[model samples]
Target: MADPPPAPWIGSVAPESVLWPGVRGTQQAAEWHNAPIDFWFLPKYAHLPHPVVPDENIGGMLTQLSATLRQRLDAVPPTPPPRRTRPGERQDNSRLKTYRTRLRPNTQQMEALRKTAGIVRWTYNRAVEYLKAHPNASFHDVREHSVTEDGLPLMNLSWVTPVLYSIREQAFFDAHTALRNGLADVRAGEIPNFELKFRKKRALFSSFRIRTRDWDGGCLKIPNFSLGPGQHQTKIQTGIDVPSLEHDGACIKQENGSWFLLWQKDMGEEKMRVPAARGPEMCAIDPGVRTFATIYDPLRGTAAKFGDGDHKRLFRLDTHLDELISGSTQASAKKKCYRMRRAANRLRARIRHLVDELHWKLRSYLKQSFDTVLLPKFNAHQMSRRGQRRIGRKTVRAMMTWAHGRFRSRLNEAMEVV
Candidate 1:
């Protein structure tokens, strides 16, 4: 291969961005994070080839650069991070909630994600194994030994060492936290044993969490998720066309045969003046199989049914999937199994689309029309079980397939702060 593109960046500029005063353009209609930062270079800095760096914080970077150029042009030093409130004074926090959607990644991107996740899993497993040998070892001890020169063979992290060093640090930090918490629990007699939870590849430990403070434009650059100091942006992260909202971090997972990026998005909306609470003109929702919702307004003494939201579509999609599976068996399956995984993936997409549409419709309608919405708590597992004394196996099967819990969650998400 030709010599790798020269490292476009020299060193992390002091206080981050120093070339902002020259930004003449913002964004081109292009792929989200991979696009170059279009800036107007000053005459003095014209010799520099493509000063644009691979960071998603272009807006914030430019803002900083503008300030830096102002200072330099006026013969003064650059400024630092934004001013904070009275030294130790605290700011009041409002009720915040996270709304998240699955991230869609291409084949190449999915493989890269899988590789990164593998690194975390391997490191975690290796660290646990080493700690077992030296039961008295502390977090610091295990961390130091795992990545050091002499400890090379102990974990063999040559592949992911440099490219994913920060991510590894994050993984170890999480492991340390778990160990510390377990130790504390043992001392306090909270549980009988202090065995730390092992990280598994495909179970409750399937997800790999990441909180990136760096400027790699992949996923962390989305709105409130970016830890860098700058004005919060409203742009989408990578290729996902999601609404702009704040989230703490993202957890990466491979579900079925695809990757998912899960994060909590704040669901609050700008306040529109309400013409009073309307004195408890309340509404109650009763869920049903034939109809998705039955709304009862006691004040008006009226009852109305909302048709089985997406259940029909879900059932239709399920039928299509069954047909696909049955046909796949006829495709030269003597040598090897020939089920079309791609068709199965399409069925999954159909289910996903239906669920999304249902959630959006329910949330918007309830918020816009009702004053007080009362949703009954449900146990879907118990509801789905057809005990020996029970009837309607088909009903139980339908109940199991439908997303009752997700519907309840959407209703809860719609509730405003009291």
Candidate 2:
């Protein structure tokens, strides 16, 4: 309406001048890309307007504005500006903290962990099956049948004898909880129906919790495992310090042929420390599919964008992965299949890594400035529907891959949300 709020950051600034570097420019360009269709066309023409539509004198002005913005965008570097390092301070003060690191488990340890995960899955499925067959059975009945029968412990079961007793118990409890919650949701009319199904052989990742008691100084002691003492301990990625003595528990999981540990801790007396005073007091962010976020600091009348050119890279990776998947399906040899599988995994990881890196960059920006952040009332389903109908399928695909829900959640973690 009102001339689209006079183009956030470009009001009186000459097009020839360099504004804020990478992130800000890329995001502003994203806004420019949508300006014609969203702001001008629908309102003025009531139809999709061509890029160079002939409208009275306004058309020429729009053309010049578009060209100048393009030239400015081309002059700016593609890569986002380097992150400014913060001076040493107590940054991590959350009461509960989670530390994640890539696990470097030797062949023996990997085999052991794999076996332990299998056993856990088996225990979970067994419990669920029992519950389904005996719908009125209590959790105790399910637990007793799963962990023990006739005074014989789970260890007596050949399949469960290899791993620690606690792991199996944890899996059985998890299964019972899931079934109970599902039933509750069905009764509450929150879900149309529920079904208990077994974990398939193929899964995105396999994970099981290791009790604190099971650890022998980094090493997980599994019965009859070949490795002895230190030889079986999974090593964390270099430079990450795991709080050996204070960690509450650990979950080990395998992701795309790589192992990782999610270590948890309770920060007994630590609390959230106030972030140093910097930047603006508050900023309103318009999260988008093409741009990570377009942020406007009303007090300063300045705008900046956060996401680097990650969506483009993600699309390329997605296409490459699709090709790899197609090739893998047609391959007859084991070697080809293995190679394709590895390539696909690498692609998936890269896509995931890019999104995570963008989120962290956003979080860092929030922490360093803007004491209070405001996010629009987002309805993802409605957005998707409107985007597909108005913007086309390609735009809708990007919207879906934006991981907006995850982005919002990470923002919540970083600061107070309004």
Candidate 3:
């Protein structure tokens, strides 16, 4: 049978419009635009009968596309717009294929899903390790050693073997093909030892399977994987507002505790078509040690503060963990250290949660109060300069380890930082 036609392209409103006022007079103004809807080809092997595509293939495709676009821009001249379509040129929806489904997996299914993910991770890492150990070997030769009927270097876990086979049979060849073609241009002598790593957790089973269509008063039926065997199947029907592809939807583990599925209907390619309203006022923010965040709202002409106590609490937790570690006897030290580590982890998680909450609160306030948000483009290395100048060398090193850059970036996005 012939391949399916490309998914329909939908028109979408600009998201940047919501914050346009703050960026109106600045260079950042150029960054805002109507969200463009373009034709994105679904992978040939990603059809329902097929399993999920391999990470390496996806990563290589992205890498190759980036390089190609970069080179194309350098070589091509700017072009003028084409003429508008005549009245008779429009196509009918009758011939189009539109799919909408709600997906949900039970508890046992969630475990199966996790196993599939773990298998993929192991495969990619094993491939990379093989390449490193055998630099002289080509990817094709390495694949021979790395992959089995189920996948290369099989895991100790036995139950998910079928899933592994599905991935290997469906995606392994395509992934290898993409990777080989992508790296073909690299000079043999200049081959980098390191492989490019894609964001793993976000990419796993990113594709969604259609469940029931137009169920639950037009809400897509989504699976609840967290429910156990007795309560395994529950459907969530999110109203017509389709979930964005980039947005992380709720995932519940299935009854078998292996498979996972998206808890909502994916908006898919239609997300870009929605219209965006202009944002509120603009603000300038300074994030630092003395102040978690110092915000200067241009619209209101006022500053706000957040995250003041986080650093102190983090320090206290660290000191306590250190004291616990230092005093524990060697015989019981390992268990004591584990407890301390767990406590420290919990404390750190709490701090992170607080930070996230503060970020959202500040963003919400700014969105309601201002049109734009401005923030210093801070480099953490530069911020650590003071520590290097005044504090001991080791102290400076320690200070540099904190996620100052990450926090600033998160805050900047929240406020639409230019």
TM-score of each: 0.54, 0.65, 0.44
Per-residue lDDT value at 181 in model 2: 76
Best by lDDT: 2
Native-referenced Cα lDDT, model 3: 0.41
TM-score between candidate 3 and the true structure:
0.44
Candidate 2 lDDT over 225-327, as tens digits, reads 6533455334333235553625434677788778877776664543433342222355557777777677755344356655534567667767788899999
As for model 2, its CA RMSD to the true structure in angstroms is 13.8
Candidate 1: clashing pairs of residues: 20-65, 24-40, 98-264, 98-265, 99-265
lDDT tens digits, residue span 25-109, model 3 = 3333222222232212110110111112336764565456445544543453445455322122223221222332333434554
Residue ranges of candidate 1 with Cα displaced over 4 Å: 1-96, 101-111, 131-136, 147-150, 154-157, 173-206, 215-249, 264-277, 298-303, 309-353, 385-391, 416-418
Assess candidate 1 and give its TM-score to the true structure: 0.54
Which 10 residues in a row give candidate 3 its minimum summed lDDT? 39-48
Looking at model 2, which ten-residue stretch has the lowest summed lDDT? Answer: 39-48
Candidate 3 C-alpha error for residue 262, in Å: 10
Q: Residue 145 in model 1: shift from native, Å?
A: 3.5
Off by over 4 Å in 2: 1-99, 149-159, 226-239, 244-250, 267-270, 273-280, 297-302, 308-310, 322-346, 386-389
lDDT of 1 by residue, 1-418 (tens): 3544533332332222232222244132111121132311100111221234435575465456445534443453335454322212223223354434566655544555666777777777767677667767776687776544466563465565643454555565566556666777788898777765667654322556655343234343322222222465322234454433243345666655556666544334353223223434455676665556656553343444454343555666777887777776766763333336456656767676666565566667677877556566556676566563253755654554557788777665555312
Top candidate on TM-score is 2
